[model samples]
Target chain A: MNTPGHGQEERTGLGTFADNLRKVPRRFIESMFRTGRPDSDRSRNDFVFSNFFLHVQSVRTHRWSLRWSTTWGLGMVALSSFLIATVTGILLMFYYKPYPEAAYQSIKDIHFVVPTGRFLRNIHRWSANVMVFSVLIHMARVFYTASYRKPREFNWATGMFLLVVTLGLSFTGYLLPWDQLAYWAITIGANIAQSPREVTDPIGLTPHFDPGGLQKLLLLGSDEVGAEALIRFYLLHVMILPIALCGLLGIHFWRIRKDGGLAKPEDADRRLGGPDPEAVPAWTAAPRKTWSLAAVVRGRTPAVGAGAENTVPSMPHLFYAEAAVFMLTFLVCVLLSIVSDAPLKELANPNVPENPAKAPWYFLGLQELVAHSAFAGGVLIPGIIIVGLGLIPYLDREKKGTGEWFGGPGGGKLVAWSAVFGLGTVLALEAIAIRFGWLRQWFPGTPQLLITAINPGTVLTLIYGLYSVYIVRRFNSMRAGALGLFTCFLMGFLVLTVIGTWFRGPNWDFYWSPSQWPGH
Target chain B: MSTHSEPSPGKPSRLDPEAMPRRDFLGIAAASMAAGACGFAALGAAKLPKAAVLPSAAKKFKVTLPESLPSGTPFFPEGRSVVVFKDGDRVFAMSTVCTHLGCIVKPAAMGFDCPCHGSQFAPDGTVLRGPAPKGLPWLSVRSAGGGAILIDEGTVVPPGTKETV
Candidate 1:
């Protein structure tokens, strides 16, 4: 058990060197920033000269304990991803061009001409993927540990935003290569992100407006997969997304400090009236020592006697562990990059039309909606989905549970089972339809299915509404208010995502391409 | 019991004095040990850096001619610069380095590509790209001051400047 400072004994007289330097002159002090006394301890000096990786991770170490280290380890994955992206991105910048025609050609040159250009590109691509995945897993860990309970709700929201932005960063980067895959993938993605109905029907004059106009408008600045799109993607991927991520990440970290560090899994049980009598006090009541207070305002009780009185320091065990994880992830990414180069397709030709154009896998859920009618999956379904997701915190007001796993005696089984059952049924039905070729009728040549008659969306929505009603009745019978409401929102998202994936068939069945190229 | 002697006044009390019981001490120790183990495991899981030193056996190629390329054209002359030429296709040779903090710039129809931060560059090596302060640098060329076309890979001319071969 060598503590962090064990190595420092060998360098005890290091301060004398600084003292001698300080005695040298006021002239030197004026040359640099005029500073008074040099508080130059060995560790303090270590902080200044250490590598960039170590610089960011130089937090105060506490007594030997593992709880803080695990959290640190998880956080390090994201930090490492960011670091790798920065380095690889800088290297790639040396070879990449942002113009439309040159973007793809430049990438090709990097692959074929420049020394190790392929390796650099592959690292950047793989690191981006790794970063996104790590962030997601980190979110999951935080949720399962009940870190988002009470005082940390704001951080939770910020985490959610970061998740979206992370995906956005990845999505925007997809189009920079200006190749066929990048172009079609972006087109499909934008088409899937049709404007909300509310935006189109402000006064409700037209319950349904053609999404084509809005879609085109959104793609206006990026008409072709040329300079405009490349520039847009570049700015978004490097500048905009990074800034947003950094800002939110700062707030997220601050929230952890504000909420009183990380919440243990047992916090959920304690919050939900468990037998733990020694609950910590609310953050406001004992603000300075608490890691985060967002949970307290959300009606969670702090662990009793959990104040800073006997608090352990955040030692190197966790920090070292986190550093290791970061290295491992980087190595894995590099290995993947070297082994597998990302797919590079033919130069982008907007004139050529490809069948079964699809969006990114994440948006497959939304694409599933296009199977029903143009309006259902295309216009109406996506609109509802976004609105619902945006208003999640407001819609689901259950306070009894925290994290993915519920607390209390029965442990959120009711909500969990219902969600599983509902989603399971929809998936099963959709799989059956796809397997049976029942959806073929909705293809381009076939007549469009009746909006209400054969639309899977209509049936799914009706089923969901009925389930909601049943849940409400069941809640009344069981006397569960908040839990019931939470279940409803969760169920709604799961259903929409699953159903959206099912119905959104190839091309979104949008006839724009064919209509424009008549007699082809 | 009646015959028992009284305790001495100077001696310390034999009654329990420590705040924590043996069970509590053992529990805390075990918890601390578990935490320490987790930290160690996490540290152990870190990945190591790959060997990045350039191989000694690698070959090098040199450029011969410094052709006056049009603004938007790419120069992929077999093994030299991989920059794409843009801006109406007359094609001037430009570096693919993104000016905005140096991510390799990709070529798009509108401008140069920045996959890291979306910086755009125009054909004439202008800052059509963002996060970049300036445009890509053009390599200086000389006709070996004689019959040979000698490209000085070391010397770089700023964008928009014309140099003779």
Candidate 2:
């Protein structure tokens, strides 16, 4: 084990055989790994290129990407979180049972009986939450940077799908514990999904003799969340969503290579007019050939004019970035696990329902919206958000601010304005509905369709739409308008979620302060 | 390769960019603070004997309410501390324990109030807001003879019962 100062520096003659042990690994690394030379660029590139596991990363990466703020290392952290989740989830599965009767008891045993099972469950729970959080943050980074430009549109769309898949994973996993908290959370989610009836009722629209029931049917596998729903969620959480997410995540990562590495600033130039592709001169001087190629054989395919400054090989630099993020996530999860517990309430009893039945925190925003109208927050808005986000790369196709955040000069200002407008609108609508409730109260004879359509939720949405259209026309840039509107939407989500998580009391009624809650 | 790409995606690319002080400083600071807080909390928890965390609070609460609770009005017994709603034949009893932070709720005009977080409770044990997951729980109440309404606060029973007059 001797390696100079490291271990057993001087070995006696009989033990000399073991003294040179470090040499065996060094030789193996040189021969097999090719990274024994380490610091040299060639060795670094060879290390990534030769290794099957890391071959997906580029041999070299732009130094700009290494900055933590650029992507916040979210993509790497999310991947690490997912891996941590998978390992812990597997550990939990060994002790958990899918059946309703056994599920709650099993979770109890994991907390109390199994060795370190609580820690494993806590890691799984927190890591799952963190993965979803990081994925959303990653998307926001991509959106703000306008990285989803033209050719990258497909990747952006796939990323949007991945986000939905990530949400699905969380929602499905919510039911496994089978406590009152888990059971009702899923029940509320399932009910919310089924709420197309509320949306359809507004327009006197029948979903082709009720296609509205389809979503509920698909999610619940029955009329209500019960044994069937539990099994269905378990299957999807354990089997379907992970497999789907993994495959799509693979595509999402691979497309980065295809679409070109992380979006660079100059990508903006590619959108608008740029330094004209070095004037191509006709090869009239090529004397002999009928068919001739006068191409200036580029200096290294991807490099051509790519100057070498911040470019570092991904072998160690990026690999280390991924490793660092993973360790950080692990340490944080451990610390959190040690201090807090994943919550569990009484065993699920269908007979006894939670008064202010709620969904998971992530879906609580929609639940808050649902308190006003099941369709708008749960059905329509969420649907539009998913579809709209997917189409964003294609919608605001301006090359000018292709890779720039916010969009242009006043981009940041637009974001603030949009966020304020969005938040103010939600709060104002809630306040108005609470104060007057004119549609539901004063006008009893009015058709529910009219009432639901013009209700506070719908009205505010329309107002925001009009405001954003005005923003677009005023700004003269489609990208600027998109930035404003998207920022507003993000802020609105936080507002609604905060209300749902904290301020709303039983029956989903608004409370101005947490102290005002009727939970005496 | 190309030292120029865009302007480093969103930010202005500059000399000594990765060292662009604020972001890294904030990130490291936040991470350490969170880790430190968690470590402190864990250490605090470990230092305490298990009983300190889960105090053996007297869970059983037996309250005797006056025979008549003005119909539809919330009545707090003078000596006993449970809130009972006795409307006509129906009688429901609720503990004043704020499920959120364990603050005792005092009877208010319309409902109950926990001064600690301003969590409001309806005449029935519904949570209005400060912050907790669920509403106030209803404890079991059955009529005992001789104007004595026996209330058991240990068992959690569902509300909406019809106490036939």
Candidate 3:
């Protein structure tokens, strides 16, 4: 209360001294936080409003936005995983050396000598893996929910950049151990990065400069993975990528605020059909209690329609939930660290290359693409996917069904058809490629560019193009088209990753079972 | 939150207060509990487990290549789980034991193969395929007295005793 200065008039000298003594700690705390006492509601609000860390959060958030069902806390989990990875990565860095000669030994020493060293390293490894997984799921959720509409399009683009940065970080870290897995995986990746040359090098298509080869050179610092490559990758993994991710993440969250927080169904409805004349702003007339957003999202959705705006302060609820999730993630990481060991091989020997060398798992999809035609599979497809993801907001500009799964109307059926069609096409192409080995065998002397373009890539392009056109025509909506294309991309990626990781055995040949791999 | 009255021209004076909302009290209580929990967690984390130490003896070994070994052939010592490769004129000794779980790998079609896991090594001791995190060790191979190859398992040293043909 504002009664503090006047209340001193009634106190005796001794009572005044006691009161003043109590004020000492209060004054100190106030000096530190630059805020009021938290006993009263006014002071409690001030406490959050004045605090630097808490002030980044919105003063209040809509009730529907808080539903665990809606988001599954994926974004938070991804950020949490990043935090764990950063901390554990730093701890592991104490012992890690980024030279080909020393890296593997250093890793071995970490596992054998440093007592919680292996645990910390394992956490870092898992955190990187899970962060990528969580981000993929988060992107799927955002895409399907149609959260990237209108003003949020750029934010979605920022999210795309964040995903790329995440992949970059995961990849650069792969080479820090400098073991066989690290060496060959990165070798294959570097080769894939140069895949565009598969097209440009032949047929006199060379421009003034070669950017693809330049990129590969920059990444490797040479023609191959050696000391220069090791250092370059280490710098990228430890320094550049993390900084980029952090900066992009800041932009991403800030854009969420600028774009009016997370997407909601009613937002889509209102924006799409113009505002309802009868609908009133709910927050201005308060003391009218209703269900929180978290409640209805957990299966207590409003009976009649979307209810009054359910905005709640971030002082406790938002902060608590975030903190709890972070703690839970860290605890889970610790348990996983205790149970598992990160793989570390013997010293790197450049003379001997892994016959079926592969890239890090996340890049396996691209690797699978490169296996067919370096340019089409690696350079062209992946580049298209990344560019396509970035351009989605501009491409799908319709405001209808912006925040509902696959556009919320006849969306379920559209999604089913799209999935079936997309999956079937991808599997069929793969089946043909496996059965005939057309790309490998049929193209005896033809240039790689023509063969790559004709076989499989052409099939993929035709199927996808037809499927997208069908989606738009059948559903008579742009949202349906967007949903279909996205489903195809995601489903294709998953299929390729599965095949590359499990089915392909020795000499990059397809095997039905991993156990069937003919290894020495 | 911006609704604090300033003793304005309204009927109620500063003394007549309205009822407090449940969320305000809940916020204060939750904040305090969170603070206490953080404090305890910090105190607990202050004492980490003891740092681990590496055993010095198992860290290093010395192996001399044998004269009987041919070029590109791995020489397996009678009792030691180590293979020394004599490539042309150069000598490289590698541990036959899988780096993964320490299981001894036999020569397979690729190079060296782990039976426990599907880790395959090339002839020169690098991973051809892996569940293995690393390649086979390229132990220091130097010319030694009477052409005998001395082998070390865990760590590498410059081959003081290299085999001379």
Give the alpha-carbon lDDT of every model.
Answer: 0.53, 0.69, 0.70
**lDDT per residue (tens digit) for residues A1-520 in model 2:** 5455446456566566675674788777677876565565555666676676776666666555666756778888788889999999989999999988699999999998999998899989998888888998889989998888867899999998889989999889988999887776776676566556654544567546555566666666665566767777988999989999999988888777556567756543344343224321223333223112111112222233433234555757788988999999888778888888898788986534454556778887776666555566567778877887887888877776545666553477878878888888878876776666545456544554564466665676677777778888897877777787677778778877888788767645667776776663
What DockQ number belongs to candidate 1? 0.01
Query: How displaced is residue B97 in candidate 2, in Å?
Result: 28
Candidate 1 ranges with C-alpha deviation above 4 Å = A1-76, A143-146, A193-219, A222-225, A265-311, A371-404, A408-420, A435-520, B1-165
Following a full C-alpha superposition, what root-mean-square deviation does model 3 have from the true structure? 16.8
Candidate 3 C-alpha lDDT tens digits along A1-520:
3445576456566887998898999788879887555543234445666676665455445556676766877898899999999988988889998887788889988988999788888999888888999999999999998888877889899999999899999989988888877877776677667666556666556465576667677677665577878888898898989999999988887677556667877653343343234433433433222222211232212212454345454555566788887888788778878788888876765544555666777778766666556567666777777897888788777767766777744587877877888788889988887777664355444545566576575567667867887878877877777788888877888898998889877656788997887754
Q: What share of the true interface contacts does each candidate keep?
A: 0.00, 0.00, 0.00
TM-score of 2: 0.67
TM-score: model 1 vs. ground truth: 0.54
The per-model DockQ list reads 0.01, 0.02, 0.02
After TM-score superposition, what is the CA distance of residue B62 in candidate 3 from its true location, in Å?
31
Chain A accuracy of model 3 expressed as TM-score: 0.86
